[model samples]
Target chain A: MKSDFYEFFCPVKVISGRQALSNLPHEMDQLNVKRALVVTDKGVAGAGLIRYVEDAFQGSACSIGHIFDETPPDSSNVVVNQVAELFKQKNCDCFVAVGGGSCIDTAKGANIVVTEQTDDLMKFRGAERLKKAMKPLLVVPTTAGTGSEVTLVAVISNVQAGVKMAFTSDRLYPNVAILDPKMTMTMPPKITAATGMDALTHAVEAYYCLQKNPISDSLAITAIKLAMGNLVKCVENGKDEDARLAMANSSLIAGIAFSNSMVGVVHALAHATGGVCHVPHGVANAILLPFGMENNLAKRAGEIGELAQYLCGREIPGDDRAKAEAAIQAVRDINKKLNQMSGLPNRLRDAGVTEDKLEAIAKVAVNDGALIYNPEEVTYEEALEILRRAF
Target chain B: MSQSSNKNDSRGLDSGGLAAAGASAASIYPKAKEPLGMNRLFSLSYPVKRGIARVALLALGAGFEYLSRHCDKLKEEISGWEEGRIFALSILSQGPSVTMKKENGAIRCVGEDLKNAEIVFYFKNIDSALMLFAGFIGAHTASAQHRTIVHGDIGIAMEALRAMNIVQSYLYPGLVLKKTFKRAPKMSFGEKILKAKLMLVLLPGIAAAARR
Candidate 1:
């Protein structure tokens, strides 16, 4: 057996496999919950996962206080406050967060208010800023992607400032994350494709962050290979359990990598797109991943080529330059396949980005946090040029 | 924070004639068109999953065509984060080498085109461009795994990273090398595995990694 490592950690108790949701009651009992709020989007509720969630807590000591089912795609600050208000009115003790990142993130924010009486998300913006622990939080992912259930970060869009209010706190980590393959098997192709790409982005970013240690490399590398092998298959046929399992595993693995090492330009760019364009986070990441990768080549030649060979599932020998070139080709080919196979967009411009505004984007991109971590040093003009080339 | 924008700053931009550094060319922004850009720098490692480049390129082309002003918004947010209090973090340090910039009255980040915006941009060729793009995207995915094994860790048995480090000795010796890492220390497979394992543990919500 290949030697394996396990440095990554999230406290969430995952009840996976066929009847994972059935374990919800048992898992909550272990956590010792009495009154838990079920947090989810309307769509998820419509899908009837709510009954299963209720059933999970049926025989348990826990009772449902209320289900704040008003979650949206880009959860705004308004959503957090509203949900928190519902939690208050219902007097819920703990939270059972279901749905994608949005619903789960909204639950996280609401828990902060219910536990601490703090609605000022702006005060807790940076990493490690939260002072007190929130009410017990349990996250159940309805989709294979959006590792939000495990991440310490919760992105809340503030409509007034037109900025994404990124709330990062160790306490933000869910007490439990229930990742069940059956839960994600029902995602439509579009959501599956976008979310799967998001997983790919996470693993890739973690492997290469400046803070990356030996530990992150192995997990990131493995996650990348998994995404490469499974994303397409899952997108092609949503019910394919193997593909679904692979994506779920990769998502879990990648979540560990980037949560520690951090991400660069693709995220920085995607964050911006999510704000102005109303594009989903994963979709934005998928669109910009290639452009960001291409820009990092010269500066990161050694890293790029080595990664390519691994992705190609081969042993690369001889000239580093040749190996690097092969890796680049591999990436291009993979992207071509994913794009052709899945209906995910391949360009920001095609997603309704205007040509005249390219210069401004370049200027803004130069300052995105991820850009700093990008292997190459990129300037505003250079960033603009990248956008231009993409256009 | 008061930097002299004089023509002769110590960073070497002032050493040569402005035209030689490609500053005189007509650029989108008059202040930015001709300033010498920074040199491209690389990270330590990456994932080279098949066909990522072509995929990213196609995605980039499509996104650029459709996304428009939202792309501009993305750029602006990055500027806000960068120009305000860019965090210059060191793996060994308690306080980041630099701090995350906050939007403060004292730190004026005017939404204006920069005369000398970047310290780096890699356009050596299209192939290089594609690799960089693919890697950047790939890194995003990898970061999630790294966090799990490192600082962000909350649970799990005997951190996976520690096990990975131990396994490195029993595993295959690395055979790939691009531009020999500039000044990186040679870590044993054990150490690398340990680090990778830890990274995966701490950062579980996100995947992949990238370095400046």
Candidate 2:
């Protein structure tokens, strides 16, 4: 279905291959920068992934000025200011973010602070609020999900305000995103399964969301096919560089798709679940994707049915509703397989969410900005119903 | 390129010489052309639509103030809001705007005062604002179509949206409501009477607000 009006944009140059990291220094030089601040989390540093980034800079004009590895599982405003302060103190010219969504978002938040020369980030929250050009940012994902690499949005929690501050702008898109198989080669089977499902959810939701357009739909379908083909393989064999690279590409492509098209109920619920229960984002998304699809089935059957070929790997023979059901079932089948393979939880309760928290999660989900783009209206009651069913 | 070079060379001339060159150019150059017919029509329509949008926004603000006093559901919806939390709906870039503040456990229309609004829903242009104000689309559809950009806590925005939905149910007829709202509201006999009352007093309220 074509929309009457839509907008799409992606300016991040993607570099994906076996040794994509080796091109980092050259990319920095292209951006006319010499010293780089490497932002990462302790987990990625602990897993010895920083060495690959360090090795990429060796014998090159650009060098690592500092490595701030204190990024928590969730990026916060405090950490963002800390990173900006370090960027200035270390005299870094650009940022190279290595890790998952947290690291990338932290780097983005810091870029806003550094470029805007503001210690208070709360004033810059919301869409297209950053007027100043950001410092050059290069992202390398150590996980195959959270597609923060290509997205123009960053979520940084304000500890004092007790709310997550979302900053969105075209300027927030990184200058380059490097997808090296070696970076994600260390992901465990469970994390790989979870993150792969996260990418799948991104592609699926982007396809049926209200903002879907021809360009985004094409990218979304390709991403879905790549994820469905490579997710299980990557989970089964973490050493398979081909499958790892494919998943990396899948995540990046899905990120671009959702960044332009935006996501819907699945991400809304997933974010709420993650915020309330401390559940891993991928786990919540993996559990709720099918339910979210089912929630939108009545309004988006045609769009959902179109995903059948990409998700199920074959044309489904039925009406749109039946095909949509098959498409959803295919997702469930993948989840079930991942559960058997890596114990990825297939239900919210099993993923550490208690039944009592469903209502609170529903309340938060209704307030999520992503819900605005949902094809079907998701009120508090509808959101609660979806949560109950997923639970 | 030669003309541009000549203009650049003129920059080196004295002020009197420059003024004389400018006068000569003004006399030599053709008068500015009138806008194309279609462009002229569009320019003419802009103010008409902007006027309609402005009147609609004033009525909307007045309606919120009226319903906050009479509508129970609206009252309940807004009761949880913190005191003095200001929100606004406005067209972008120097367009007429309306701000509402939660005060004394009720919503009060604060007119176009946007200085202290904690949350703002900015329609990208007058056309988008006219779409919603003219009842051509609902709030949910407006948001889904990306006709508006919200700047604030999304949770508070959603709360404001719910309240706006309630006010809309009373302001618009049932047929228009059916077309615009995601779920058409069902009003009781007393509520219907309240709606009738609101219809009677709304124009006068808008007039009073406009006068202010």
Model 2 chain A weakest lDDT span, ten residues long: A1-10
DockQ of candidate 1? 0.02
**Stretches of model 1 off by over 4 angstroms after superposition:** A1-9, B1-212
Give the per-residue lDDT of model 2 (tens digit) for B57-165. 8888889989998899999988888999999998998899989898898778877977898888899998778767666678877775678878877778888888888
Best model per TM-score: 2
Least accurate stretch of 10 residues (summed lDDT) in model 1 chain A? A1-10
Per-residue lDDT for B1-212 in model 1, tens only? 23543444555664454553455432311331211221232232223322333233333322222221222322333332333432111122111111112233112112212222221111223333333343321221222222111122111111211111122221213321112111123556655664455334322211111111
Error of 2 at A2 (Å): 5.1
| Model 2, global lDDT | 0.89
lDDT string for model 1 (A228-264, tens) is 8888898888888888888887887787677656677
Question: lDDT by residue for model 2 over A57-110, one digit each (tens)?
Answer: 889988999999999999998999999999999999999999999999999999
Residue A357, candidate 2: Cα error in Å is 1.3
Give TM-scores for every candidate, taking all chains together and pairing residue i with residue i.
Answer: 0.64, 0.91
